[model samples]
Target: MPKPEPTELSRPYWDALREGHLVFQRCSCGNAWLPARRHCPHCLKPEPRWERSSGKATLVSWVVYHTAYHPAFESRLPYNVALVQLAEGPRLLTNIVDANEALVADAPVELQIEWEGDTALARFRLAHVTV
Candidate 1:
């Protein structure tokens, strides 16, 4: 399997993830971006800077993949992958710890960092959600 690629535009986001912080690009025009970009979508200006988020969110939707499309995900089958609307104003797609179906949609969650050497990927889990 191959490693994931990070473009220059997304370096800050990936870097922040490694440090256990959920940072988003905040534009001077008052817009916040997800999946980080270099220019502000609203103003089309280089008015973006990384800002830390509160790390809180609500599960908007998710899928339980019984199959793995990549070798890296093969051992982690049946994991809950989801899109969460963070308190910071961006919707992030991440994973949740394997929990019961009852805790699927609309559950509150928080961001966590999955470290791989010098890099880390952002993952999420049920916040205060008891097993």
Candidate 2:
């Protein structure tokens, strides 16, 4: 798997995930987003604070990939790339683990951090699934 190169602005987010927490930036004007940015996409306000997430989200949409565009992903063909809307209102592009063709939109999901080398990634699984 590939590793993420954290920039000065996004280091906090990556670090938090490494510590087992998901976070996003929110502006006082009531807008929230991910992939950390300098200002609110809604109000364009600077200094959006990093806030921890509840790790709860809903499957908004997704598509199953039948082909691997990257060499690193070749072994994981037929994977699902999903758009999950966080309970706190930010949407993230992530993968749905243990997913199949039976997956549907609006299904509730919870965060599950996985590691690749020393990097931590925020993945998700169906909330009601038993382990």
Best by TM-score: 2
Q: Which lDDT values do the candidates have, in the order given?
A: 0.80, 0.92
Report the lDDT tens digits of candidate 1 across residue range 1-131. 35558898887777777777988888888888798776888899885888999989998988888988887888877777788888878888878764747566787888877775666778877788567
lDDT of 1: 0.80
Q: What's the residue-level lDDT of 101 in candidate 1?
A: 75
Question: Over 4 Å off in model 1, which ranges?
Answer: 100-102, 129-131
How displaced is residue 103 in candidate 1, in Å?
2.9
Steric clash pairs (candidate 2): none
Model 1 TM-score relative to the real fold: 0.85
Q: Please give the lDDT score at residue 39 for candidate 1.
A: 86
Clashes (candidate 1): 0
lDDT tens per residue, model 2, 53-101: 9999999999998999999988988899999999999999999996577
- As for model 2, its CA RMSD to the true structure in angstroms is 2.1
